[model samples]
Target: MSSVLGVSVGAGTVRLARPQHGGPHGFVPPYTFEVQTLAMPEQRAEEAAADAIAAMLAAAPEVGATTITFRSDPQARAIRAAMARRQLTNYQLVPEAVAAVHFAHATTDMREVSTLAVYDLGSSGLTVSVVNARTSDVYQCERISDISGDYLDSLVREQQIASGRIAHPADPAGLAALDALCRAAKEQLSNSNAVAMPSEQGLVLLTQENFEALMMLAIESSARMTRDAIIRSQHPVQAVLVLGGGARIPLIARVLERTIGVPVIVPAEPETALARGAALLARPAQVPQAPAAPTILPLDDEADVTPAWLTAPARRRPLAALTSRSGQNRREVSAAALTVSSLVVVAGIGLGLGYGPEVLERGNSTDGSQAVPATTSPRPTQAAPTSAAPTSEAVHATVAAPPVRQLDNEPTTSAPPSQGPNTFTVVPGLPPVVLPTLPPVVLPGFPPAGQ
Candidate 1:
């Protein structure tokens, strides 16, 4: 037996689903994983989506086939290329609305209904679609408005600001946090009579009735669009299916039900319905057959058989034909080896050029000829000792030759230098030579030593 993987790409999130094995509606998937869509360029978004799917596939390696249902054609193509690059071979595309209809047919009593409608209230916008259940064809699909869950959250945020609950309403970050809180409160109000929103000011209570009142216009607009789609389809819709993240609000369903005058149904785990439907469609109806034999065409004696494009003078081999895994690997290895070898040769040449003069001088000095001695500078000497006598001998001895020189070289035949009364001359070479200091070293998790 084989299994199918279904993926649904929405404006704000991407969801994955796979069928369960043991129920009457076993084709309907129970497992799912959702990832928020990245707010990036088109190409980056596709890459992000591919990364998410790859992660899911890594967790569940048994999925043999995949079906990706998309809200738009461009997204479908981009995501399909992403999956293809990951080698997900057995996959197909289904429109989001059609997938929803397929899901309704399989999971609900709408299987016998000829026509059905689906209202998908997403984070960014609302989509209303009327589909023919029998043909899986969408007859009328309309995007109601740009207003959505985000708009509702903003309304709540405005209310907070007007009530002076947010001190710094002008701060973008603070406003963003408040908007998130408002969205959470809106979601909570779906199941509770009142939800508390915490802020810097204090706890702000939002009742379900007030929340619905704040979003009344958007709710009414969505309901009107659903009703319009049904009427435009020109067929009686047996049932209306409501699903999406935005549709989680209880008021949306009640309003739609009252407006359309049809029994509106919110399926269990409705968010996964589109993905599960795509997975159901992706299930292989029959096993693969054996490969067919290659066809051999007869050659004509006096006719040119080659196609015009292939026979053209400027024709070149296709890029796909020129590429192969082994060839690419061999080229990459050769390039790396060449780079390393070039770097080694350049480094050797540079080192040789830099030290050539010094090495030659050392080698010449090693030969036995007398080498020139390095020049040396003279150092200052200490004062001579004086004898305590009043005679001419003692006075002459007091002004005698300088004390023994600090160096081994003989003293120069020059006049004695003048000296001060009680100070000794500072020896030029005797003062300790101070070496240059290095910067202190820093270690991880420790402070550096003092300079």
Candidate 2:
């Protein structure tokens, strides 16, 4: 009896399916891990891939298997390293989006459907697959950056700041704390009308209305991308299918339905459908058999394929062929790339120069609107009974006066009794400032006239 292992690596969970004979397949308990560090610049996506794979392997060590399949397109080195570490050999990495296609074909008897769109809103990104329903194949997959429900959490934080509802903390501490709060709020918002993030800054309350308002952009983008995927599938979509954790969001399903003009089909356990489909693909009878003539399914025709699941479009590339080219072609492509980079730099500089002044001017205006505090002089305003108010010139002269009488030793009878209204003499060594010179005096009585 042959057995197969199917692994689905998601942002928040890693699912493993082990198909056993004559019953529901056993699944590994879901492993929850944050893809936080995976967002780092270097090797981050791969690191997330590897960490997820490791979790899957750890979950199902006892499943008798010669082959391991992955929804993630793992790099050869990473897979090899994993296999080496596990001391296992047979492995295959394929698109996770193809899971439903595999599952549909295995369990259902229908084979004529030609096109299906897979809407995958995973933890990190929103992915849509346009596939040929006939071949159990994918035509294309497109992903948007951070458009998942997790991303909606970020939108919520931004809305909070924009609405003056809350203030984010500073730097690393702030980021970590905000992440925690947003995540908690997201989970709570999923279930309740409101949630609060209690911190030293006080509680930040988020209502469902606020959450949806925050997520409008992401929701709209996801819907638009889903619609475009259906359009690009180049087939009259028989159905628009929803899967992934984000699919569980009612708002997402509603948006997809409204956008695609088809009822969003929410299959049972949509999150695990992909893993189940992969395991089903491992079954001999479930594998797609090629037609005798190696016929390519027409983009319009969704038929004559094994497993209704696998009957989707295989990956298709445009048929343009490149004839032999000289090194000049390489140089041309490089030059084009360099020109694009230069244009980007110029655009950036233009933006900075054009907007930088406006920003500075606005800052100055804001400063001007604020009241300037008056400085209180330490000298008493109340006059001594015998003294008159000093004239402005006298005050200026007094302020301009330099300190004299530096004492080398303790005070003695030799110390000067200050005279001449405490005239202050200039010190010998200090930084000096010169005021503008008065106009040169008219020559003395000697050169009268032009002389």
Candidate 3:
């Protein structure tokens, strides 16, 4: 830029900056800077900015190259109007956020910053801006109306009144005066441990600790809003730049740093940072192409998102998706094994009922004498065999034989017990004098009775 004047017209103050230059008249010594503070209104800020610049030029024609910053349509209109009225055309308007980034690049080691959060705590309200460091494009921004310098001033005023240090003013003019006094005290408290101001009733004293205590909630609210802006931007912010008069209060940076979990950057002159940055833009300087905002992950310092266990890992998640298939399989196999064992038991019981008693009777034959078998039930466990009568629903063997282990594959006959192996015996039929020998009985799904 051919001009070197940077102007930022804020709600509470108008900041102007230009390079150092010597006076155009006579042989004057060179001065470092020729800038002035102007009172600007919020609604007509742009128009006031134009008026102020024109007035400055009128006073000092050699203020030299001038650069102004503007953000809205009204600013442009105001600049055009100022130029047309002043009969001068040596000015350029730069975006305010872009100018601040330019200042950051010039002053500090901003290599770590790609996305910058400009927390401007001005008089009327707070504006949180997430801007790209390279192009100075705003990615996300928010205007918080609840907190501001004026609000903090009110808090100080109320606390001072409550302490009995000052009586509440009766008239509007007096109230305004007291408020102004409190505002100054608040600003002083930023740099000093305590500030004492003369008021209506007495000297109102406010300490730095007390001031921070009174404004803790408001600063925390600003931090919360800033965190939200970062989350909405969907890009991680490396650092934050604190601007405006409120930035002078050290507590704001501490709370913001703790809450946002990032560095809160404050320049040498925070109240005039924007103005100086604009002034830098008014001059010809290299604007570094900062790397693209790093998007390592979605960042929410508050981390107010749905819990991961509730929605993620839809397949085979250890916590949410437990399977019972193995337990069910084990139960199914046990049932099958129980069924096979039951069938084998029933078949063995049937074979014993049909043949055990008959084998015992054949062993009791009188024609051959032999030693009795060692296997026998106790006398109480056995029942006597008889052949007197037959009255039964069906024929049955009454012997409950103990299982015997076969030692050899040879046929051998064993003598019956002296009593009998039967628990109970069925009676023989009438008119049946002799009984023939019974052959071995074969049942399905079994080997022959004798090999």
Candidate 4:
């Protein structure tokens, strides 16, 4: 069997994973390791994505075959467009939620789950997906741009300015540093009650209570949206699999558990769930088949880790030309990657620009709005939040075949605390492969709270 590498292309970051072993029991701890250190610049559309992915492939030379995942149609299109730029035709893009379901089948108990709600709160946006765990069909999906990790970071910056932490550095470097500090505080607040850090100006301290109060309004709104999605799924949702970097926030999980009234499950490292799933799906496995001839055979969920709809996509997406070594050699230097001036964490990007989600919200309905072309200019200043009610009933769109009926095996992973406020992925000072242009910065007194 050929080895496959899994890459999850997020708006702000890209994560890659490769599984060492595969079977019906699925991949376990130490078998799958995910690398999520590379950050994608958002100013340019396909150019940035291409560069980031190309860089990722170059960083990992052992990869043979590869599979990638996308959430929205825009991401799939963008990935294709990026491939076209490099004349890379041998590439496939699978749905992000489907990849997560594959991972869930391997890890979580699938005995009772028929439908699933995947709530991902990443750096760029909030994507809520209602999917059939059996058929891999997307029943209902929505994206909220205004309330994301970046937006929350901006809110923290606004509060910092209001509290007189330091004068707003008009230059990009200063702005980046301040935003990084704010992002660190937010991530630390998720795991601890209070976080104190030193900056160029003074010591910054943020309490969990203060942080929750700051984001409670936005979190509550998202919770309502999750509840509505579960109801709109039109099927009994057995569990809610919360994925993404922001999913680290305990408050987000608590509010979701309370609002959705369903058990919310967070993987060992919530942020890399999709990438790890992609890694497992990338593998070509020997799926145990139910014996023919009406023989009495016990249902062995462990030996049967096959997904009807998921396996097809992964198999269909295998491209001969997109291996690690050849891809980088074919076309990596084609795009110009404009490096950021400093090692600034862009967690507070959306709201940090002094704007609101109204700028990000194109149109949100029961199903969700179509993705438009991304603009290079900054989002317009804050305005009234706009929302469109669901005009039509939810359409259940199925992709392919069999349900993932894996045994109720609790999956495990040896993931590092890489998703923090100040960074998209990777522990500070320990990125998998550092970009040549943007080097690391050193802080004197500030404690790396989240890491």
Candidate 5:
């Protein structure tokens, strides 16, 4: 028989709620009860908040209520301290910002959406918070102040005053009542043609058109802040979540959608989202005192996580096409590699020339005469062709043969030391001589008889 109490303290009234567990849905209240609305003077506005908790405990004491949890507001700290003085130990306090996030978690089966913009518009003031929607067993929480709904309300109020629908300045009491009326009218307008406001100051009509205009300021203000919050989260947002009573307004959703460029989710019982969310936080299944933070494990930081852009359909190029492109680039790279190899080979040849054997030995080995390899290596077939023009052996032999003759024919003033046949060098270019062979052909005896 686990039970918890939820209380909401507004400007003119305090709502005392007791949620009974294991009870069938659509269960009616035990008896007709009315919430006591206290004036601001007696409770000093902040102190009056404690009465709501006291009233809830008084309402249902039969249930085995182990804990009583209340929604936190600006006045939470003071109210909580007062509750502690009364020795009400089985109670927990949650900020409205955290309560709203808990509400989204309990009702909606979403987690790891670490950032949420909660816009709470009530009878008096609006409250907005950017909270972490962590999905871990030990829930984690954080808040950014920019996306507050209260600021939007002020914008709307200023716009309304500028338009001269109200007097110079709106009193607190008048603003409270008007906000309450506008809230009711806003809800009614959601499902009807025109929500009529029956008041002492005649009938004020809130049509969809008028609501849109008045809500524009709130929307613009909220949208700007929402965009800022998304940037500050430093994590990609899975959704643009809307809760609390004001979240039901269509204008609010439209503005958020337009600003965030994402879908705006509105869950059921928008008015009670924070209260229900607080109730869930109070009665968690496993409350670990030293549990890890809920949103600490970012999607980007997770080992098994893949980014949305990575998972979504991409323009996949065919492997063959990519290979072809790679081959084209590869050809260019191969050319570069060949050029570099050639340079390295040329450098080796130049270095070998400095410390290597004579050019003749290199030529002999190149001509395939030496068993030992040439000191200056030949270029590989695949290597770049030698830049040095081919030295024609025919031309070289012709030039060398003439040089040897020129050295031998060089004239000297003094004669040779040895009168060798080499000393009288005969020069060719002279006339030819004929021999008298026929006259001398006679035999020796015939020559004597003739004489």
Candidate 6:
């Protein structure tokens, strides 16, 4: 069975999901790689993303295609280059907000809705998209990089520091651990009124109210952006679909619902929703195959190959035999005869020019009444010596020879040259002809011909 791997590369984490073969529609857990986006360099973040994808591929070797979600074009390009370097084919890149919208449409109760506002609060920032739910198309999307889940985490950390809950806040490892703890406490506050986190100094307690107070500005800004995106889409939003790790906070959803005045939906697996949607969009790459060889039949084979209906009236004769018959039609016979005669005439003319007029004399007697017995001369063994300048008679003979006549058939032998008027050599069967090189007849006003 074909399967797709959906990868969501967020600011703080990279998540992967593959749809179960026989699971219920819109249901599947995802694998996530914990990677800090703001804390790590760009190169390291990309490396983390690549490592996550590689791990997923190693775990699910059967995945046929992959779809990755990215928040920005540059991030998408970087991830795409990394995937290409890994020789991964049949992969697609989609915007994070767009993928989240697709997930909302597939899993949430917003399937029947025509338009929706999707708000994705990731670790790095918040992105709002106006989606045409009926078509699963994103019309417009807006991103605020400053107001995000990570920003809230930072605020929570500051509050913890001010409350004197921990020490060594400047230590890199301690800061990292505190951030993780803060994220956990924030997630817990979504479910309960308060939560506790173990830090370097001691256990830090965070209340839902305190968490909301710290993240209220970011939440309000995100809600405003979502409203603006929906208004810009110019489509009535029936509901709001929220996703991303940062969006798990209950306060974010409640504030958006109150601000946008629409029902807000959070999927059962909020973090994997984008990945699942991406997987849904993945398709197996089609490998082109060479066309099958054509079936050939032997030329010598003889059988009744005509269709039964076509042969029902009468037996068909061979096409070649039918056309070869002499009495097939008077027009056809006349045309064939004409063509043959014309070809013979042309061949005789060509031979007369190449070998001189002697070839035409064989067809007629000296008196032009009967055919002559044409003689063949022995070919010279050596090159014949050039003759001296021609006399007056020889000049006339060369210039006044008759035009060669067209022959009815090919000549078997050449004729001998005989003396004619003015000592000109003539072939008996040819007619008198004028020379083509003779001066053109000039008119009085034509600039004296050549001029």
What lDDT would each prediction earn against the true structure?
0.69, 0.59, 0.72, 0.71, 0.54, 0.69
Best by TM-score: 6
User: What is the lDDT for 41 in model 2?
Assistant: 28
Q: Which is the better candidate, 3 or 4, if ranked by TM-score? A: 4
Clashes of 2: 19
Give the C-alpha lDDT of model 5.
0.54
The segments of candidate 4 whose C-alpha lies over 4 angstroms from its true place after superposition are 21-31, 44-49, 52-62, 284-451
The Cα error of candidate 4 at residue 193, in Å, is 1.1
lDDT of 4 by residue, 1-79 (tens): 3456677877767777766643223445444574554575764544665665576557754444566888778778878
Decreasing TM-score order of the candidates: 6, 4, 1, 3, 2, 5
User: What would the TM-scores of all predictions be?
Assistant: 0.57, 0.49, 0.57, 0.58, 0.48, 0.59
* lDDT by residue for model 3 (56-142), tens: 778766555667766555667776776777676767777667777877786777887899998988888888888998778888867
1-451: candidate 2 lDDT, tens digit per residue: 4445665555555566656552234333232211111233224434454555455556645444322334345444555575566555545656665667766555544355668777877667777887776775777788776587567666766766666667767787786677667766775665688787776545678887876666667787788877876777676676667787666556777777777886566765667777776665553334568868865766546655555555334322122223235456888999999999997886566445443332333334433331222462322322222555344444434334412333345454554434354344466443333344455467766665565
Please provide, for model 5 over 214-268, each residue's C-alpha lDDT reduced to its tens digit, 9 standing for 90 to 100.
Answer: 6687568757765775576564455666765567677888887877776677876
User: Which clashing pairs does model 5 show?
Assistant: 103-277, 128-149, 140-294
Clashes of each: 0, 19, 3, 3, 3, 0
What is the C-alpha lDDT profile of model 1 across 1-451, one tens digit per residue? 4566777776656666766662123533333433223333334656666776687667866666677787776777888888789876666788988889877777667646787888887766878888888898888877755677677788887786677766655677777787778788887776799987778755667898888888888788878877877887787787788887676788888898888888787876666677777766675545789999976778889766677668444354454446676689899999999999997886566445443332333335544232333562222332332433234343234224212334335556644444434334466634333444566778898876653
**Candidate 4 Cα RMSD after full superposition onto the native fold (Å):** 54.4
lDDT value for model 3 = 0.72
For model 1, what is the C-alpha lDDT against the true structure? 0.69
lDDT (C-alpha) at residue 362 in model 6: 30
With a 3 Å backbone cut-off (N, CA, C), the pairs that clash in candidate 4 are 146-357, 301-407, 308-402
